[model samples]
Target chain A: MEILMVVVVGVMFTIATYMVLTKSLLRVILGTVLYSHGAHLLILTMGGLGTGAAPLLSTEGPHSDPLPQALVLTAIVISFGVTAFLLVLAYRTYKQHKTDDLDQLRGSSDE
Target chain B: MSNLLILPIILPMLVGTILIFFAKNHSLQRVIAGITAVLLLILAFYLAHEVYYHPQQTMILELGNWSPPFGIVLVADMFATLMVILSSIVGMLCLFFAFKTIETERAKHYFYPFYFFLLTGVNGAFLTGDLFNLFVFFEVMLLSSYVLIVNGGTNYQLRESFKYVVINMIASAFFLVGLAYIYAVTGTLNMADLAEKVGVLEQQGVLNVIAIVFLFVFGAKGALFPLYFWLPNSYYGPPAAVSALFGGLLTKVGIYAIIRTFTLIFTHNTGFTHDIILALAGLTMFFGVLGAVSQFDFKRILSYHIISQVGYMVMGLGIYTQLALAGAIYYIAHHIIVKAALFLFAGATEKITGETSLYKMGGLLRSHPLLGWLFFISAMSLAGIPPLSGFFSKFALILSGIQEERYVIVVVSLLVGLLTLFSMMKIFMYAFWGEQKIPTEKVDKKETMGLLKPIIPLVILTIALGLSAEPIFQFSLGVADQIMDPSNYIDSVLNQD
Candidate 1:
């Protein structure tokens, strides 16, 4: 199960890297989203997955580490916030510059 | 007094959040931010005093009463409190300068809130004892900086901010990955606990990899060498006040993290890690000054200098001695004050002449002698001239370097100083000392004075810091002592007795 999860994360990261390298702004944003999801999965899998009840109950069976789950949740929320902000910023860039091509945006003011 | 450790983080957060409601009223925002900034300054000073006088006592505040290695802990040692004090001083001056300089439209867009949020993140990063908490605080600082940098949303700002945001986002992602790997190997996230665990671990192959990962994670943010390409362009886009704050405080946070982790947690292989740092320091200084020398624009040159000065601080850490660390600490303080003052001076000059290019500006000494003199003092101080804060800090770092027989870096550092002086003199000669460029009718002395007002205190503070170098260096030596021996930090956080 952990090996499968690792492969999935690897695939996601590869896709994210490819997309981020593209010039389109929206693709870059999507790439960040995908990248963060990959990171979240990596975190969970690295902690070792377990089939158990919620952390509150006292159970005889094994319980998953609650810490990585908590960490993932925080990471997810933070990334979501950042993704939203990036989208708005991209939209603003599109509105002002009228293009999303990263190459074109390379020229700073002094030019 | 442990509770005071958390106030530096909380007070700014609370003030920033509350300032959101007053977004429509610019004057009210200024009033509230000013008062909160003053309060933060006082609080930071008090924290500094408490930590300095009682050096052995590490003030640790475990949030929600959870114990160490489990709960989020804010640790205030001499170094952390000193950073807080320095940050608040910079924060206050930036706020004051912003009041007069920031566009009303930008101020209406929750500028005060974001400013304080940035402070909250900076202070939190300094104070947090957990590695994960540091990542969260870094995100907070970066997020707020994104908003602050693009406050005006001009074409240039939008473009540079897009690049800035993307680079930082990638850095943050790597930070998370690094954290996950570290936790996977060590099964811990609290820095103190991690230190204890990693100290005993023998298989350091993965540990060293993780350390390099962290160096990259922070190097991007700190603008180290090849990673610094994003800084000069992005920084030039923001308002001078915003740029000043970022230039002064932001990269230092990255340096601080490097210092904190390198000193405390990653002490296993100094041969590999510190050597890498030393080489990077050499390249960062050499290339950074080269970039500065090649730039004719005022703000861009200063921005490159930021990268150069960062090298010196990191070099001190690379030397990894008590005196070297102390010198680095002093250099950090000195750089923050002088760099921020120079940026502010740049802003004032731009306001007067309506230009930042050295070729387009001249004869400021004839029209505005006060601004010229102030710039001369700050620029001289930045170049490590004697009787200024810069000279003593550089002297100490070099003295320690020679004692360690690291002659190459010492020579590189001194050469960088010479180059730094040349570029600064270039700015002076072209921008301030030549024939009057701006028409006499267009130069408004009152407006220039308003801008110069906020810089006066920073200049005075720099001079005073220089004259009182002995006491300050002694204080930093104490800080270096505590940092060099992390057992005290570990005991205070973990044992909690």
Candidate 2:
């Protein structure tokens, strides 16, 4: 089961890296999202395959490690915030400059 | 009060949010930002003294009433406190310059908040005791930087800011992934706890891999060679004031983290890790200076120099000796002041000439002697000239390298220093000492208002640090000792409860 999960993550990561290398600004944003998902999976698998339940131990028996779960939760929120900000920035750039092609934007070298 | 720890992080955020509403009234907004910067400077100094006087202690502030591992903790030690002080000083200087530099009306409302939040994130990143919280703080800083970088939505800024945001976001993801694995292996988020746990896991080989993951994360952020492409471009998009603070404080926070984790949590794999780091440091220094020398624009040159200077700090870590670490710390302090001053000087020149290319600028020495000498002092110090702060730092590092008998690295460092001087002289000849050209007409009184005041303290700071090396070196040595021995930090936090 863990091997299968790792394979799935590997494919996701390869695709993400490919997406990130694209020229469109929107594609780069999607690439970031895919890449983070791959990372999140790598973390889960690295912590030996699970025999336990959710991290929260209310009346449940033998809880899973809550620490990684807590970490993942925070990471998700941060990624979400960044993604939203990026989306807005991409929209603003498209609105102001009317293009998402990375090549269209030549930065200042003289200044 | 222990409670004051929250203010440095919180007040700027609150004041920044308030300023957004009054953005239309630019002068009023400037007044508010001015007051906030002064208050932050005072608070930072107080915190620095507090940490210095109480060495070996961790002043942990738990959010709400939660206990360790349950709540986020801000850990203020000598190192973190020192970084906060640097950030505050940069913040004050940059905001002062912002009064004259930032002209995009659309950005006026959001700029202050993003600026404050950027500092909040930087201060938090330095102070957080938990690895996961560190990731959060990294995001806060990155998100704010993204907004500030692209705020005006100019063509140059938008294009470069996209690359900057994407690269940093990927770096943050690596941090989160690294933290997750660390937490899974150790079931602990607290840095002190991880410090103890990771040492025992090195035999498993998993720990070494995790260390590599962390190195990737921080290496990218710190602009270590090969991971530094995004910086010179993204930073070039912002105005001078924003670029100065970013040049001074942002990347150093990444170095601070690498130092903290390597010293505290990942001590088990030094033999495996430091070897790679030593090689990278050599390359980083050589390539970074080469890049700096190739640049013709004033700000672009400074941007490239930031990458080179970061190599010095990393060299201290790679050498991994007590004296070497102290040298790195002192070098960081010196670099922040000098680099910020150089950038501000560039801004001041831009203000005077309405140009950034060194080719288009000359005769500044004839017109503005004060600016010319200030730039010269900063540039020379950056080149590691003796009798200034930079020379003392590199001297200590080189001596420590010789003591360790690492002759190759020592030679590499000496060559880098000479190249650094060449570039510095190039900037001087092109911008300050050449034949006079028709100067840009001086702006009206209101436009250049309050431009030079913010930089005044930074200039004084640069000279003072040079003059007071003995005590400062002693202080950094103390910080190194504290880091090398974790018991003091561990006991202080655990005993506090």
**Clashes per candidate (backbone, < 3 Å):** 0, 0
CA shift of B97, model 2, Å: 1.2
Q: In model 2, how large is the Cα lDDT of residue B231?
A: 87
In the range B48-166, model 2's lDDT, one tens digit per residue, is: 78776764555777778566656667778888888888899888888888877787584464887789899889988988888877888888898888888887777788777878888
Distance (Å) between predicted and true CA of B259, model 2?
Answer: 0.7
In model 1, pairs of residues that clash are: none
- Identify the runs in model 1 with alpha carbons over 4 angstroms from their true place: none
Query: Per-candidate RMSD vs. true structure?
Result: 1.3, 2.2
Best by lDDT: 1
Total residue pair clashes for candidate 2 = 0
- Looking at chain B only, the TM-scores across the models are 0.99, 0.96
For each candidate, what TM-score against the reference?
0.98, 0.95
Worst 10 residues of 2 chain B by lDDT: B440-449
Question: Can you tell me which runs of candidate 2 are displaced by over 4 Å?
Answer: A43-58, A106-111, B104-107, B443-450, B495-497
